[model samples]
Target chain A: MSTIRIAQLSCGTEYSGVQFEIESAARAVGAKIVYPDVSYSQVKEALDRFGFKPKSTQLQLMIARAMSLADRKFEADAVFITTCFRCAEAALVRNELRRFIQENTRLPVVTYSFTERLKAAQLLTRMEALVTIVTRKELLARERQSGITAGIDSGSSTTKAVIMENNKIIGKDWTPSGAVVVETAEQVLANAMKEAGVEMKDIEAMGTTGYGRFTVGKHFNCKLIQEELTVNSKGAVWLANRQRGEATIIDIGGMDNKAITVRDGIPDNFTMGGICAGASGRFLQMTANRLKIDIQDLGAMAVKGNWANAKMNSYCSVFGIQDLVTSLGEGKKFEDVAAAACHSVAEQVYEQQLQEIDVRHPIIEVGGTSLISGLVKAVGEVLGEEPIVPPHSQYIGAVGGALLSSGFL
Target chain B: MKVFIDPPNSMVLFDLVERFGHEPLSSMAVIQEKIDNIEVDMPPMNVTLDDVVRGLKYAGVEVPSGIRGRMSLWGPMIEAADAAIIIDNAPFSFGCVGCDRSNELTKYLIHRRGIPALTVKYPTDEAEAKIMVGQIKDFLGGLKQ
Candidate 1:
């Protein structure tokens, strides 16, 4: 039987973890995911053709691309939209695009709102359910076939590899990415291959996605390379599949922060901040080092301490470390100081990146930083609501890459 | 004596006014006050709907309403000045599209006010800059006399 095809649209970022989950879910349900060849220039062309001047804001550009995507030709049974939450612009754009799709096409459209607190089980259930629903009508139309595929996600901090056979994840491996990304990608892929008991000849297809994906793909000679935002959004939605309403995906990585709004099951819009490490995991790591504490322990210490009154006002990581030292010398308890540090990062994100965005509830936290219990707690306190953190959040990107190889060759 | 300066944020004019021992009236102070008291996570201070209404009310001109709102903000400052110095073709002075009208109205109001006003173009070369400074010095000195 011919495999069902799903077209994925998103602003590609490497950290969101949505792409991995969507691919996995699609593969499990006997479907193939395809990405469109839409670019900003094409979007501009479409806007010009429609007599619309280019807008200065990034959200407007993304919306323009989405509007143009509707007119472009591609073969797919369904359309999925993924975006960040709390984006006022995305909310406005999504409403317009939803109407455009309704008026222009008969294909089923589903939008997933990705946030930092999305659960893997919820995402998987929804994806599996989507696949079932999409494929149900054509069940007797095609013959079923399955094979093995591999995905490698070479992120800033780590390289992850996952091998899948007939939609189920059979084997996966991850290792710290050191000085040479090429070597790390090779090592991780080798490790995954060994565990899966499969050779290069045995794998049907291979795909690479992440920050270092382009470099790694060139070194390894892999043909299929996907954008990080596309895969991460896909992965996040697949994981948070069960979520029924609007949510924002906040991925705080080592050096960057991503906020993706998922409305329903599709990603709507996204914003990113990474010019400095002040609003990222690097900030927390640096603060922990200055406190002479392990990074992992900072969160627990923060929870026990009361430093709501103490201020760490520096937005630069180096300046923040100085602020931490000054606070400690001023007789502030270590626990309180640490908690305050976490609070400061949260505040910076709120003030800088998310100020214009009216963030929706049930914030889903992802990326490696989401593991920091104290930072999560601080973000909750700042937002005046708790977030959902799914298990194995770091591997969502890698899994999304693997799922991309699903469908007919 | 109060002297009004165009491109209200010009530090050069502000410093010259203080150096010449005069009170300089500009919109920078008002803008700064708004920025200082802004609520966290909100859009940065800019010309807002309220400012437009207030400016229109102050200008009391109905035709060519496009620039009336902005002109109102500068009208009161020009009215209180003993004299005015307008630096033409100033860097970063490409105001919004409607600014031409605002500029026209501002100059008209200053003319009507009947204050001793000096309009100077920003110097391009080092020699022109020196000459421009001399012209400004002479104008202020004449006012002092």
Candidate 2:
């Protein structure tokens, strides 16, 4: 495949001395940054035609370049609009240019506001996402698994592995994530292979995902290494049997949470971030440890409990656990305390994430937390609709990898 | 009725106001007038001495020429607005409005204009976008045409 040309549309990148960071980020992903060529006359014409006067000549050129891209005067695979964070006018123009390009072309667009302190590492993920959108459009479009494949998820809290043959999950295994990412991945993959009674040679293609995807992918020389947003949403819809319709996917992981809205198995919109771990699986693990029960059994305990009796704060994980301690010390029932923890997590997810999506029917909940009946129940109760917690929800990343990697086979 | 939107050239607020049957008083339109008036020899350097004097009424002489130049367009739009919608905490990309002093002065002028102004947070997702649109619809519908 040829190198993707991402049209750079921005102001002050050169002046702020961060142009090299942008170039290096694109180069790291096997892409090249191309500036849309604009003449002085074209700049003047664009300034006159755009109907907004910017004080900087660079801004005028930026407008003209955006017009050039929109007019098909420049050919590129994607568009990256950027401006300094300090420039309010540049911010407005950057957004306007992004909207203009999206309206005028089918090109994928990613916009950023950078500071002088910007690093190439900060821009790598955005560049990689753009490259994925451009290079893997066909792989992303594949709806089902084909041939024999395996997937590994080197997650933050736990590592998971899955093996599939001809669209069916043959075997899977999961364990607590280890200090050494590659060793943990190797063990999980070996365990899963043993369960499936297949040799490593039997697996035709392999894929890796999660936080340590790049490190593990490099170690294993996998066929696909993808970001969790697209891969997880794909795996989720595939597992829930909602490939043909619109559905919302919710994944509450150890450190962060994701809420994505998908249409026909392709993710059109997604929001992933957590201000605190209060809304993640790690918080629940803390809650279970405090209660002196097995993490797996906390869900059943919470089911028999009523959350209203032990209201807890859902803002910070530290404070949330503090509230749990107080509730338990105040002679609150263990069941109620457990239920409140589940309710607190559910409420936080609703407040923080669910509001970010239009929320289609049949929400498919996937993630390690999905197996906890209390969390699943709370999510359903808070959403006012039961989410379909598909089988093997904890191995979503691994399953998604296997499902997507099979397309390459 | 002319509706003013802060960041003065936001396409989203402009389209929403226009879609509901009102003129969106914005810098783009004001700039369009200056750009299209071919009587001025220079195309974009349309800020006249008279325009600079008008801008001084909104901002101080200590302010940057960029702010003063922008106020020349935004000041008139704010004065001409029958109603205004000001989006708060809008992401930099939503409408850059680059000059901080100019943005603050513009918002102050719009608030002091005493029109029925609606202030809203910029929606981060589709659900919030829907709610924002509904709020705009209600605010516009309440106006006595």
Candidate 3:
């Protein structure tokens, strides 16, 4: 009954599934959609004014344009917008995009963080039922798409190998990060191909993404490679929609932690991890070991936990143990202590993140620690809500990796 | 060559100790809390080098001492090391040496000597790390371009 105006802006290199989901969600929501317009309009205009495209100039310039466009759109109940994924991952571009939006639009700015989808629920109509769309293999295998079209995602701590049969996920594999990216990529390619029950010969026109993708590509071979963000967004949208309704994705893995918002079931805005491991998987794992509990149980237990009054620990893993032990001796309950740990972790992440990421919707937690049910609850509590723990939470990254590798990204 | 391993409880320290010629002592920074999280060989991780003296004496950061001597610096206690072999599985670059220029220089020399420095932080991609390793290898390999 309402006509919501939505704009979906992504760099030319953004993943396909992410685009599709956004478009689809808008269609379902009856929102008038705009594409390729955000704070980056100036850069886009600047590009137009200079009579030079990205290839003619620096990659940074082009990245800036895309971010600007995204930021402008985010100003409107723009749902999800990305910020501070990393300084190295085209930050200036994103800043210009953000600056333009803050200067130009009257819309409330909302960062697409793990909190977005979990919080977007505040806007859901009481009468509208949650609509879930799970593609499984259909989107990944669309016959209309072909020609080594692909996406790649390489994390600092892990490598994901995905194979798509016409953009439909055919296989996926997750491998530990290697000192040499190319060597690991080769291993990923072999593993993904076998998992899809297919062979390397069957693949044509390969695309890749990730920090290691470049090195991996140099060693192995590929027809194309996409940005890691794009691949992750697309895969996340596809995977999230399969279960319940489309929402934002919170991927807290071993190394790279990300929060992707899917408005109308698409990637709107997202955020990623920085140098601090405070809210990261390794930190959680370390804390788990410190408590002598397994990482697997950390989440579920937190969800069931009672309150405790532990001191806020330092971000360092070494410091956290001492703080917790000291708190325990001081009579802090395990539940409160656990909650405090989770709070500090989330606080560490949100500290540098953009303000205004809605904290009331159904947040779909993904990545390695995303499997920790308690962490989700604890993080949600700190953010003022409870997040949705999905099935196949740990495999989401691998799933995304496969889809991108298969050309979906 | 020195290796700077964190979370002193790591097996990596022991592995480094066994593989390398060093006894891989824990960073006086905090062992126990000091144990390395890595999967290498190293010496026993004990003792926490803190700015306890500075915090109590001057309310600032200072250099942590090793079994060998008082590796003095300024500010809160700086972790002690000779050369460093960082093996962090996470991707973090926002580390600072505080105001203890002396100790900071010492740690820097250990890392700058360029033997093997590994560090881990989060939210970074694997490819990026690989590129760095590739560069380091290239430097070490000195494969004539």
Please list the residue runs of candidate 1 whose C-alpha ends up more than 4 Å from where it truly belongs after superposition. A1-147, A165-167, A194-202, A221-223, A243-245, A356-358, A407-409, B1-145
Model 3 spans with C-alpha error above 4 angstroms: A1-152, A166-170, A242-246, A263-268, A307-309, A315-318, A328-339, A351-361, A395-398, A401-409, B1-145
Which ten residues in a row are the worst by lDDT in model 1 chain B?
B56-65
lDDT of 3 at A15: 31
- What does candidate 3's lDDT look like per residue over A189-216, in tens digits? 6777787787666666565666665565
DockQ of 2: 0.03
Each model's lDDT: 0.64, 0.82, 0.47
TM-score of each: 0.50, 0.63, 0.46
Per-residue accuracy of model 1 over B16-95 as CA lDDT, tens digit each: 87788777777676566657775433345455644554454333222234454555568678878899887877776422
Best by DockQ: 2
Native contacts kept, each candidate: 0.00, 0.00, 0.00
User: Model 2 RMSD to the real structure?
Assistant: 14.3
Error of 1 at A164 (Å): 3.6
- Find the 10 residues in a row with the least total lDDT in model 3 chain B: B54-63
Q: What is model 3's native contact fraction?
A: 0.00
